[model samples]
Target: MIDWRQLREIITTPDNVPIIGLILAIAFYVWYGLRQARANDRLIREVEADPGRHRKTQPYEEGWEREVQVWPYLLRIEFLAALIVTLLLLVWSLCINAPLEDPANPGQTMNPAKAPWYFVGLQELLVYFDPWFAGVALPVLILIGLMLFPYLDASPLGSGYYTLRQRRVALGAFGAGFAIWIGAILVGTFIRGPGWVWFWPGQTWDHTRAVYETTRDLPDLIGLHNGVAKALAGFVAIVLFYAGAGRLIHWLVTRSETDRRIYRATSALQYYTFQFFAITILAGVPAKIALRLLLRVKYVLVTPWFNI
Candidate 1:
């Protein structure tokens, strides 16, 4: 059932090797961070129960000052880290060949022509979204959303520390967006084959393979054939989706007393901004992905200027 040869070729490609390394690094760091967070959370609970006890989340000796000089204490460690990274880069450069191809030819194009690995996620989004939406609007929204995070989040807990229980709503929203981006990259790298068709990891990359699947827009499914009717239908559907998803996310975020307090402290502007980005990016993305993949529905919202 598995084609080892095909899988080997994909994994060994020079352009793909970095993605493999990225996956490993992400896994290790997430595990380590969560482990540390658990330990710190336990320490926090103990200190809350017994205020007389003196404890530090980090290791501290009795004689050391609360802070140290940055020149030697911090810069030295940074310099050493830089040197180690340089050495590793040198070794890696020597071991692997650069992924370069011959000069481009106007007559022939490479099958499954892909963007650089970093932009592969956006490229994969083309399957489910229009070019303008995938390439421009989504990226702009993501940048703005990131910039708005600090202002939007009113929580003071878990500052400068890795603790999930204290910052569940903030962490959950960010983690969901990050996971979606990473998933898109992985799918683009390993699962997309010639013609941008979906292929299982072990399946052969057939150059001549032709898929003839028909996709439909949501409006078409409900017998809305006229252009204006389709547009109106799509607009109504999107409005309803936002209303439902916003309510659900609000309930989830305000389940705990801490969360409810934070929510109450936030200004209307901040709350609305957070809800807009959360529903659009965090919830809208997976919803669209599901529609496209499972229901074969495209362009849930179609207007004269844009189709989403």
Candidate 2:
């Protein structure tokens, strides 16, 4: 069980105020889900009572009624938006001073030395993965995922409108990822102290505090620790997991002939590759958490070149 006081202390920090953005994002999704549920219920009831009421709705007329000219009207709105953003930034800059540490010294290293707030999430991931994997490979995969998302997400629902019911999977995945990244940044900024020890808000930063977390490698967990054997076992395990999951998804999800045709038309190998990368990136967090909590397994595929 987590110590609520410790967790709360980690969260409740002046420097960690931006973490509220993540909380707000989650709350917004909760509210959106509720609203979408109510909307769905109403639509179902309406359809049952009068099936033809909404069915006969004509195509949207994209004339003056549905369109706005890009003149004084749109221009004025855009100007006000920019003005408000600029004013907010000006006020924020005035109120909060930027954090500037002491001048760089080659010999004097700051314990828990963090990247900028934006990159803090990736930095924190170094705890779970090797520097090359966390700092380089994952970041490259994220960029690839972003570039490949539109191709993967073929759904046409919620294109212009903001409805959770229409785009639940996409939005939920993105929101969860965003929350994790923000949460990592918050932890790095507020909870981590000297030597990267976990420190709460009320607790004093004890420089001598030792955080000795023993992490078991994947092969060690399954009682195989020979280097070559472990590497081969790890590779086989990952391949099996990926292939099993892909087969399960392919079998379980009932797709139409047209969908199958589309899949055939596209590069199926590329599609599966992208899907695997996406799954690993998104599911890795929860997988890591579960392993740490249940088995005290720190790294899954630990090799010389990479660790996850």
Candidate 3:
């Protein structure tokens, strides 16, 4: 449906949208770094100036320790979320009845056959580079970067206190990344406009399925494809995993040891294991999704070692 005349005529709309977004991003990061510098700059002292007397650290107070034990409050909120999710899942399972396709036909594949929701981002990435790059190498690199954040930017500002602005910025960005990942699924399902086709499993599989079946033309912008979306997703993940979320995780897990190297190594090892499990599960997405739907099985069964 794309012709030179029609394409040329469609260029009246503004094309600087992504550029504006990039400019805003650069400006915000610069501002954030400067603000951090200012906060730390105030704490700096001149070596030649009068030496200040440092106060001795006090022991933990009984009253303050009692106030910190809000486990009951945390547990109650967590249980409420779990109960709501379980009820919604029960309703969804009953209402949705998926029909089994005729025994995996090799010649005739289903249109828009996708992976499970958890692995959709990785599956989308697989479209960009080779399976090894998308499914393994990139995820490994991401994991390594996430684990190295503490050592890279060791600003012990909020180590013992919760009033640091850097912590707030990091937490906000981490929450935003989670929101973005969830938002991607919504956009993929609801906002993917017509006639756009990009996937080609083999060289022979012509990318005409969506083009032939759907209405409206695909986007011509730089980041309109699934591949670009995956890259954006990864970029956001890096922000959360390393810059934002990693800072919070470092504070949390290594808190008991005065935040030492041993604790950092322990947290990194835990992250490493989780990354491995996630990557493995993501690689088998196509089959995993098919089997789960067909057998009505959950990923985690009720075993003594684990509970779903």
Q: Pick the candidate with the highest lDDT.
A: 1
Candidate 3's displacement at residue 247, Å, is 22
Native-referenced Cα lDDT, model 3: 0.42
Give lDDT tens digits, candidate 3, residues 1-308. 33444333222213322233444775797577556555443333321153463211233444464443458888888999999989977875586444455888889866455554444455554433346655776567556645754544334545542333334433432334444344434333222222224322221223354443222111212233354554454345434434443455445535544345443434455555433423333223333334343543332222223211
lDDT of each: 0.91, 0.67, 0.42
Taking all chains together, the TM-score of candidate 1 against the true structure is: 0.96
TM-score of each: 0.96, 0.75, 0.36
- Candidate 3 has its poorest 10 consecutive residues by lDDT at 213-222
For candidate 2, write residues 144-183 as lDDT tens digits: 8778777776565446444544455556556667777777
lDDT of 1 by residue, 90-154 (tens): 99999999987888887888789999898999999999889897899999999999998999999
For model 2, how big is the CA root-mean-square deviation? 5.0
| Model 3 ranges off by over 4 Å | 1-83, 150-153, 158-164, 168-308
How many backbone clashes can be found in candidate 3?
A: 0
Candidate 2 Cα errors over 4 Å, as ranges: 1-64, 244-271
- Candidate 1 local distance difference test against the native: 0.91
- Whose TM-score is higher: candidate 1's or candidate 3's? 1
Residue 66, candidate 3: alpha-carbon lDDT: 43
